[model samples]
Target chain A: MDDETRALIDALVADARESPADLARQTGLSAEEVEARLADLEESGVLRGYSAVVDWDRTDETGVEAVLEVNVELDRETAYDDVARRIAESPLVDTMRLVSGDYDFEVYVRAGSMGAVSRFVSEEVAPLPAVTSTVTHFAMETYKERGVLFDDGDDDDRLSVTP
Target chain B: MSDETGSEAADRSDGTAPPDPADSVEGSDQSDPAEASDPTGEGETTAGDRFTAADRVARVPPSGIRAFFEVAEAHDDVVSLGVGEPDFSAPWPARSAAVASLERGRTSYTANRGTAELRRAIAGRVERYGHAYDPDEEVLVTTGASEAVDLAFRAFVDPGDTVALPTPTYVSYEPGVTFAGGDPLAVPTYHEDDWALTPEALAEAGADEAEMLVLCYPNNPTGATMSADELDAVAAFCVDNDLLVVSDEIYAALTYDGDHESVATRPGMRERTVVINGFSKAYAMTGLRLGYALAPPGAIEAMTTVHQYGMLSAPTTAQHAAVAAIERCDDEVARMRREYDRRRRYLTARLRELGLAVAEPSGAFYAFPRVTDVAPDGDDEAFATDLLDEVGVAAVPGSAFGSGGAGHLRLSYATGMGELKEATRRLERYLDGR
Candidate 1:
């Protein structure tokens, strides 16, 4: 396997309660190398702890995801982080990044409905000094779901089984 | 594949000046036509060993497409529209004339500017289309329009000069431009405009820092031709902006509908425009490797200088054949042109009937239709690749041309009518699944 695939194996063993062999079987890696690599990673504090990958989609929280492309006010003297924090403090804001070109930032904000999103934009998002014009695009139906990339037989088999 | 070793540059680069076209060995022998077809082996070397092994050699990892062609070639029952060349033999008169030249042993090198007789013939031919040229000073015979294009780039463009070209163009233009150390500026020609190069777009292209602008009429891939007014506008734009125009009119004589006009024929445009023409299309002599360019005297001299250093001249015997062919404008060329025109008409109608948005092809032997017009999100390359893979048809993907060709497919109707019908049938079946 390539270098990226090796690192992925070590990360899997440290984070989730999966054995090196299981990870190997899941990612098409050699079981022996996976075990040895994981041992070395743990000794270096690289393998930290096991955590669960919770099904956020099935959770009680009903949040709608939308993309917000922000064009910064050219006259404003405020820095990027100033606007970032204002949006980040709201629990609805999931991700934000400073970007190039016509837009200064891309904000991924999760709220309830269109009305609720409008409310957040007007009250919480618009009032900020560093704020600029925002264009919103709603999420359409997903044709392919994104998840952990696994190609080995075991991962395919495990995915086939429903909880 | 052969053990014959020349200068590393000769093997790796195509920029070196070639040998004299008048070399006897480069001519056709009536006894062996294949011998005449050999590309001249002299002046084939370069001075510097600059590139690494990887840079010099092309790695031929298995090509599924080539493999398919190999398999297809073995079958006698297989009717193929896969190949993109005329199925007819070189017109008998042209062949006979070529044989006569070989028999006469007029196999010596001609002037770098080409023979007086052949140049006069080319001049006469161009004059018929309203483009006046001095055969002695303006024209230089080369090895097909392909070589003329390569020479155009090398002679006119400096290291950073951008050569603007409309996309959905011939595949060779980009590589040739790059080989000349120039950048290829691809302007997207969409199906919405029926693939016409708009005046606004042409103006912008000329306004760009590009030193050269290329236009192919009876265009390849799209089979679209610019109208007389369009040609005039383009010529005016190029003249205004001082961009050298390279008009490839190889398929000029094959226009199906009406008269074929050259941009060089426009008022005051001949000086700036390089008219590239060849026998490959009209005479159905693809294997002959013969073509010519009519440029301004200075451009002709520059191209000859480059040709001398890199490629000395076009094949000698082919030049003689060309002289004979041009001298006698027989019914053979006219007959072939009529046949191609018939094929062009039939193919476009059939494609439109199939529900593909085929732009009415006024010229050339190609029919480029938008694939997504029938199948949405239909990747043209995948569609073409899969078609060849499953059903065994070998049309090129329009994407191979440029970005403007994203959802299009280029089908050549140069083959026999029977093969064309079979290809259309297969296409119909393929689209039926969609």
Candidate 2:
């Protein structure tokens, strides 16, 4: 991608809600060009979707999240793929990725409560044939998400008038 | 010639003002802070035949909005559009470079022209706006563009030589020329012309009498700018009249319309122009105080001589920081310029809706809106005061800029949307009450 295309992506990543016209003005691209590129990016699946970085503590939702490290001993190479596909389909799992680290998979799980998360791990995850050991770390609060910091308390501290 | 130049420079050095006692009283509304500190009035001994400020420095009145600043500061909820500054922090890489230099213990004074690294960066950076300065002899890193302006005047202007400054310009230009013992000639440009200085306006103001011209665009106080065609006319006028141009392009990156073209790029103009720029407004590095001047070899050498005496060099940390800023902050500047443009559009449109005539500012982050309809008796001072008192919104009165800026108010939009929206809402409420 060229610099302008990269800039357009960077801008959207920062604030997806910014208008096309404003994005164009920021990136030195015309609004029409921005529109054309957006469509192209979307069609090619390079630009997947836009979502808010929600501060759940401020919202009325009751959800708990945790990081789960699952150690699975695969009997065969095909067993790893079968286990990964099965875990990805679970409702409690937000994201699951295969890794080269100590753990076989680092899974992000979100459920209604800690009780629900514990139940998902005990009943759903460890029951797999290749699963060897499981470790779950509960997240207490989120200070940041999606590359954005929350409530930094920064304000306009400059004097009202200056030269 | 060397003796003559040396003697005059010495005269200026010796004539530098002793701290004026009256200077501290500039912004007091009722109570003097000095009186409280010295109750016995022992400070009165200063009046008896003692030397005062040099005539030129004393002639220009001090600038203040202190009374207003105090009043606005007292209010916890006041929404201010008064300061000309960016809302962003200095680019992280720039700040990190400063930290890295500090870690390396690079705090010693640098060469008077600044570190060769920063001078080279400045030479490269000015290329964006078409100024081709040689790093060795044609560039001087200054404490800030304020010092660069002063250096330009001292380097070129003889005592009593006139310098043409377009009115409704930044606060520093007029006084800087005077401080250098040059007469400031105020040339006017009106909103009818969108505040761009034409040859006609220059000629009408007796600009031929001046030996130097100061140009700032995207201008402060008034967000006026020069198109290439407009700058061509001004360049022709300067060339015909044998004038040196001190072009302050500090706000060059914030031009909303098109890319800024340095006047030095004009035909036969590079030899006679000094292009001044800084990292303050563009890079949001105001506190770092890094600025540069690009000029001909002789002029830069002369300015460097002045800088060597007053300020030996720009800070080493700041020079290093500016190198990082110059090399890496174009994307950040583009991002900021985009944000400022949005605010410019919103603020100007909102002001027009409130029954004011704001000439759509072409550059900078200010909108100079004529406040005749909303102000009492078209008095912007009273209007500004009443707005802050009644609605808790603070804006600078247009009259403070110059006579041409009378009946208007300069509202800087280099603030966040929340503040701009709040300030304008209070502005509308204040107008309704009036």
Backbone clashes in model 2, listed as residue pairs:
none
CAPRI tier for the interface of model 1: incorrect
Best by lDDT: 2
TM-score: model 1 vs. ground truth: 0.62
Write down the C-alpha DockQ for each prediction: 0.00, 0.29
How many angstroms is residue A61 displaced in model 1 relative to the true structure, after the best TM-score fit? 90
Best by DockQ: 2
Candidate 1 displacement at residue B321 in angstroms: 1.6
TM-scores for every predicted model: 0.62, 0.81
lDDT of 2: 0.78
Q: List the residue pairs that clash in candidate 1.
A: B16-B310, B17-B309, B17-B310, B17-B311, B18-B310, B18-B311, B18-B312, B21-B316, B144-B291
Candidate 2 TM-score to native: 0.81
Off by over 4 Å in 2: A1-63, A67-108, A112-115, A118-141, A146-148, B1-51
